[model samples]
Target: MLAVALRHLLLLCLCVPATPPLLAESAAPPAEPLSERQRDQIDAAASYALATTLFASSDLPAALHAFERAWRWDPGEDQLLDRIVPLAVSLGRADEAIRYALIRAGDGSVSPEMLRRLALFASESEQWDEAKRLYELWLQSTPESSNAFERAMVRIELGRLYRRQGNAAEASACLAKIQKKLLAAPNSKASRQIITGLGGSLSQVYEMFGKCHLEAGELHLAAEAFSQARDELETDAAANYWLALLELERSQPLDAYAHLQQYFAAPGDPLGAAPYELLRKVLVKINDREHWPAELSRLREQHPDSLYGLQAEAETLAAAGKADDAAPLLRRLIDDALSEAAPIDEDSFAACGVWLLRHYAATGEANRVIPLVSQLGKVHPSLDPYANVIKAAISDNAFAAQVNARLRLVADQPQTNPAELLPAAYLALTAGEIDLATSIAERSLADDKNVEGDDLLSFAVGLLLADQGEAGAGLIRRALEQGAVDEESPAAWYYLSAGLRGVDDTEAVNAARRAAELAPASPEFAANVARVLQAAGQTQAAADEFAAVLRRFESDPDPSTRATLRETRLSYSYLLLQDDRVDDAVEQLQQVLDEFPSDPGASNDLSYLWSDRGLHLQRALRLAETAVAAEPDNPAYLDSRGWGLFKLGRFDEARDNLAAAVNATDEADPEILNHLAYSHLALGDRGAALRDWRRALSLIDDAQQGLLRAEIEQRLQDLARQAGVGEAPEKNPH
Candidate 1:
């Protein structure tokens, strides 16, 4: 066994084989006196033997020193330098190795091996300039005795290195040489031997060629090269992955799926970084649902805690209306993450907690969010997770105690990162904790003399939405002037549009359009583009964008994609509804509900519209009930149900639900207040109706004032007359 292992280990040496031993001196006839040169050669042979012994013993540093001594003693034994340089480099003495390599090349030595080895070292270490220089020298100094196939391989590697440094013109030059040479001798013995030596590296060369073209945006050429590589090497998983990516880009999902299946079936890749999420999505897009469950189960079994596995399982379960099953899996994942021995970076573990909080928030299961917050609070070093939980609580209508506990969890935590403070401020604003939001925002901006572009943008957006619009805009302008904001960044422009939108500025439209243009692949960005266009009265343009948004999502139907699809449809339909395009809006809304039957927001919106327009009270009641069932604690859904009852003339039950909805949160929503006022009017509590409408009007912003002010003021006057309060109504008690 030792002999067999050593036989294989001999290949690791640069030379093909060791020198043979000489005949025994005692068996030889009497010899003449040695010449000076012969004496030096005999001494060199002794040094070489000692060096070989040291090398066999694995004392590489001593072996290299002895090998250098042998080379010095016998200037004729050039092979000793061959052993010395690579050994030196392997021992982390690269500069010294290169010095000896330069000495050999400058002397126009018989061997180019040292120069070639130096080039390999430089290339492997990513010192592209030195690698390029050394490769050129190696090619120039290569002895005529070197094999043609080995030289061609070096040229191929040099081309690959050039491409890696983004010098595509030079890379193409080298590839063109190889192509030209191949054209001349398509099936030569040299080529056959090179292929035998390369094993799978030939496929890697072609794949890199494809990547060079792909990076240059020459998609057709890239696809051609990748297909050629896949054909040449049937089990080349990298080539298959590239081809799948290119096919998906071309909107050929079935072809992409086929190629991806081939990729995952290949050997030696069960543990490699397969594009599992993209494969899952492509399987979904092409309706290959039958194969997905088994594939995903295999993935989870193999990579249980991987980002792809965890997210894929959780997303699939949630999508199938099995969020209850998904929740415990996410909880266990978080628990396992938190149980890790103090890792150097706990961000990934903390991120797991955020995903659980996100799922609960999205499903309107706010109370489920509290326990994860407790888990994260104990494990996380930063306050970001607590802030995220607060946002979840605000969304899910969680108990005030739960929300307050998370709020306090982050309140005393020291925020060293402005990025951290921004989320906290956003949570405060969303939870109606206005003073805290303002305080954090102001503090963030005041301390923003030096911070990342993301931190500045995040803090600015928080301030803008928290009613410090002018101050926020000022910070944004400074960031723009200082070049901290990239004009082409979709996220930066998106935030810019958010800041400008409150003042109804035309630039907001341009900013939104830019974001849409930069992120044509993002459904959320496209939806934003459509929304701003619709708001700016470019209805036709907005309609086109909304249509584009739908087209973008058809090929990428993850949970977020599905959610955005619903939102895009809703935004477009709301515009149609405003224009009195009732039939068109109804068709789109019906389609949205048909596709996303479990969506609470969709149920509530359509139900509220029916009740508001007096179009279908009975059906609206059913829709409202569905929304309430989906999110029992949601105040908006409760208001919808209460108004549906008011439309059906069930005034007492309407007042009861309206009162419950209004009292659900400390900061009463103006929309719910308006609904409650109408319920009071229907109950003939004229004084109560007048007071509720007045309270709602005071809380209403300019955006809502335009739509509801006239109706609310009219209701107050009629209620005043009914109560006989006459011209005054007890100072419009708020």
Candidate 2:
């Protein structure tokens, strides 16, 4: 009886109640469920109550051990993992939970739900391999239990796994399967049902699929995926960033601009650095930069060691056409990256050095480039010279010859990093050794992308140089046939660009559309596409795209967006006014003024528009006055204000302001000079008016110019005739 009592106590200590699972919100759910047996056996063993009591007492670890023992006593009590797994998770012991889940799955003690629970747990724990295995197991449990949607989701997980493993082809295939499925029957009842089952969450699935295509360099496919995702489902914040990237790469600046505005407006993590970095690049490329200095300063302050921040200072200077100023900043970055950091970023240091040398070479500062390269790159023989030959060698032949010699020597070495061969190949190409360059480039291409698109870039350079001739078409075909990609290529758009270079316009556009689905790095590329579209008479489409671009800067925290938007509105309004679209022009200018009331340019534009049409004289005068107050020395703004005063019949004041405007521009602009003549006519300064008219008339031929110019010419002649002045002086520009 005493032994039985001790046994009961042991069983009691070995039993615990079920604890809840740690959430695996992002993981897959299982389809089939097995029958679940209660703790009847544990109850019969007399330890279940004690374990439950211990669990309630918050002695979780002890209770978990008790539950395990209780299950052992009654081998039929297979639900111990269900209780123990959650308990382990609750205790912040993910590894322990994984172990329990694995044991349950291994021993056939898991129901479908329990199995899925384990998979979710593993995934949430970032035990990706283990989670992947469990997901596959879940898929294999029973074919009938899982539907096509569930299977596709599993495929997506596999695709994600493949992507994570750097297997773009496999990832692309896995994702493409879903695309095919959806495309096969997009509006079918079955498809709709599957989507409904996922709570109309197919967009998220499509987004993941798009990401796979993006990773695989299938730009067009990515674009399609993103479009479906964005249009059908919830407006995901991260997806907006990807769309912005896509628009940039497509050269659809306006579209990218709009996406960026929407992206920043989303209540996502404000500290995310990618949006700002990409935007800076986009803005610089379009020469529509806003709040540039402050934006760069923010990046530096927030992410000093980040690639974006480190590159910003130099890139911004270069963008501003200040190569001399850029050189020092890059040099400083290189020096600091080389020596000051605790774990010096050797790669960054080398890249910066390469860039600085290239800039020096480009600007004809060859005397500076060689010394810098020698100190930066040659000092570290172990470093790759991929960036070395890219810019500098192309510009400076002497430096090229010297660097080429060392690069080839490095390539001749038995075990050099593949990156070293890149510069060697480039240098060989520059030297007219096409065959050698081709061979060396192939060798380098066989290596992984050393710096972003280096491998594909090498291949491209080689392809261009090898005199592949008409074989270019065949070569592209072969590339497609062989599924050959430059090593672990992340240059996804290259797939679209290369395949559709001159093949099929429809296909090219499709491919571009897909590429735009991902996070693109080239807004210029997007702008090119937009230009092509616009030239093709897709005016409305182009307009829509540009409108999207305008939306991008609307809600930005950076003042750059406001500045950019103002300029955009300024141009848009100017065009509208030129077209006699008075209402539209006013609305556009009103938007700029409403958003940036203090903007002198916007104020001047608003005032001038009203004054030009002889409308809203009082309001125009106030706006002009405000603009004049803001930019006292700006000739254009002063002219707008003077025109406003003249429209209000303040003749003498108009003359004074118009005189300043003429003097400010050295009387260069024809339109401003025309306005000054009108002001002089209003003030009865016949000689002054005659002289200004003569200059304006000499600068413009009535027959060769627009309606406005013709109007100005007629007005000048009328004023001269009325004042009884002689015909205009010959070639009097001053």
Worst 10 residues of 1 by lDDT: 1-10
The TM-scores of all predictions, comma-separated, are 0.36, 0.36
Candidate 2, superposed: residue stretches over 4 Å from native: 1-448, 454-541, 544-568, 629-632, 663-667, 701-704, 723-734
Residue range 191-253, candidate 2, lDDT tens digits: 776677656787777777787887777878888888888787455766777777777777777
User: Residue 511 in candidate 2 has what lDDT?
Assistant: 42
lDDT string for model 1 (1-734, tens) is 22222343343344432443364344445557655455445556666777899999998766876677566546556666678767776776664476466546555552477677778877776778767877778778876457888777777788788887888767766665554555366478776665666673556656777777666666676786787788777878889888887888778998998888787666444323346767977887888777777888986776555543665677678778897887777677666656762131355556556667666666656455545544664554223555646554565445544554555554545554444454555555557676665555444544445345665676677666667665566667666666666556788777777677656558878888888899978878878888877777788888878878876665453446656877888887877777788778865676566444445777788888888777567667778898899888889999989988887788899889888889887888887888888777666576687688889888888774667777678766665574675543332212
lDDT of each model, Cα atoms only? 0.68, 0.61
Model 2: number of clashes?
Answer: 27
Best candidate, lDDT: 1
